[model samples]
Target: MDATADASTRKPAAFIGRRLLSLLYDLLPVVALWFLAAVPFVLLDVAVSGDVRHNIGPFSLLQWLLWLACWIVTGLYATVSWRRGGQTLGMRPWRLRVVADDGGAPTHGALWRRYAVGMVSLLVAGVGFWWAWIDRERLTWHDRASGTRIVRMSKRN
Candidate 1:
């Protein structure tokens, strides 16, 4: 078999450690995005409220909207990166790539599903990620829901 074929056929690596590391790396850019997204919301609040507010109020409408915007912006970053290259900036360092369970690039719909499920998984204190430890195939909740998997790539010769 060709080198590419051999690499593609390998089972996904045990991923929890690498996935967490990648998330830590990805956090930097996502935080930057959150700050950028908050800019307009902050400005609008300042204009309307006429107060120099350092932060949005707890449970307020504007605060919720800002949270939603950050979620969307983060999703855009993740989905676009996955769609274009199957690897986010974070995943690159770990040699991880997201792919369909069938070993092909996932469709846009699947990618979005993956993101949404992943968000829920994170919100639940990453029970989904922990589940991979016991899952027979080492699949996370998002992986099962979205029909996708993250595979670690072999080193290039």
Candidate 2:
């Protein structure tokens, strides 16, 4: 068990602004991975033809494939981070940690669920994250649905 796992009783749910900021920070790595994910498509395109650009149109196969790749990469990054340490690179600097209902590191299944639900929340204009402000415990929709919560780390004396 990680030391931060025992924080529910001592630490509070993270503020929405903090969560948003951390997400913004996390996007840097995500975008980098996205670019990496595009490499194969570019390589294949170049090998088959002369151009290496992927046209992102409504009916573009390359676009769909790239989207899938990006989703898988994002899920891997989040799930691994959540299951291994309960924090991502962004969450680390912000002192945010994700824990299960029992305040332990989330299970793999829970982490995946959280990632999927989080995507849904984001797709819906972040209504789920906003739900935290009104939720009595300040848990987001994904957190509640996935049986997990993100908490602010307490200061260590």
Candidate 3:
């Protein structure tokens, strides 16, 4: 019997399984960041005005800017890490990694494109994420658009 045959036959990580684990790993930190950003407004409303309604000052332009900043930070973290290391904090925990479909590290351009297109996918009701479940090759819409794939790293490899 070929020694490598058994190793080769092991199933790769499932899309849903990896995604679920990644979400679990990411949820706490992401939520914490969001809460930290929102807390100042809540405190201002309570401290100066004695009312929570006006805490963020009627959701003005500055408020929007803050929201955008938070999103950008999160997106940048995900994109840069994925491109540079092939894995985000969550993906690393699950031994799943992202790579170009051609089996190389993703270029910066590809990473940006993937991140931007991912927003579109969410706006359309997460069709991009769901794409992995139904895709013949198990590629998400963002993966397809960016020419990338997420694969499980074998223990030995």
Best by TM-score: 1
lDDT of each candidate versus the true structure:
0.89, 0.86, 0.74
Top candidate (lDDT):
1
Give the poorly placed runs of model 1, Cα more than 4 Å off.
1-10
Model 2: per-residue Cα lDDT over 1-157, one tens digit each: 5656554454567898899999999999999999999888778767766665644556678778888999999999999988888899999888899988776777888889999999999999999999999997888999888988898887671
Which residue runs of candidate 3 sit more than 4 Å off their true CA positions? 1-14, 35-53
The worst-scoring run of ten residues by lDDT in candidate 2 lies at 3-12
TM-score of each: 0.90, 0.88, 0.74
User: On residues 25-139, what C-alpha lDDT tens digit does candidate 1 reach at each position?
Assistant: 9999999999999999999998888888556788899999998999999999999999999999999989989989878899999999999999999999999988889887788
Question: Cα miss at 17, model 1 (Å)?
Answer: 1.0
lDDT of 2 at 76: 98
Instruction: Quote the lDDT for 98 in model 1.
Output: 92
**Residue 72 accuracy (lDDT) in model 2:** 98
> Residue 108 CA error for candidate 3 (Å)?
1.1
Per-residue lDDT of 75 in model 2: 96
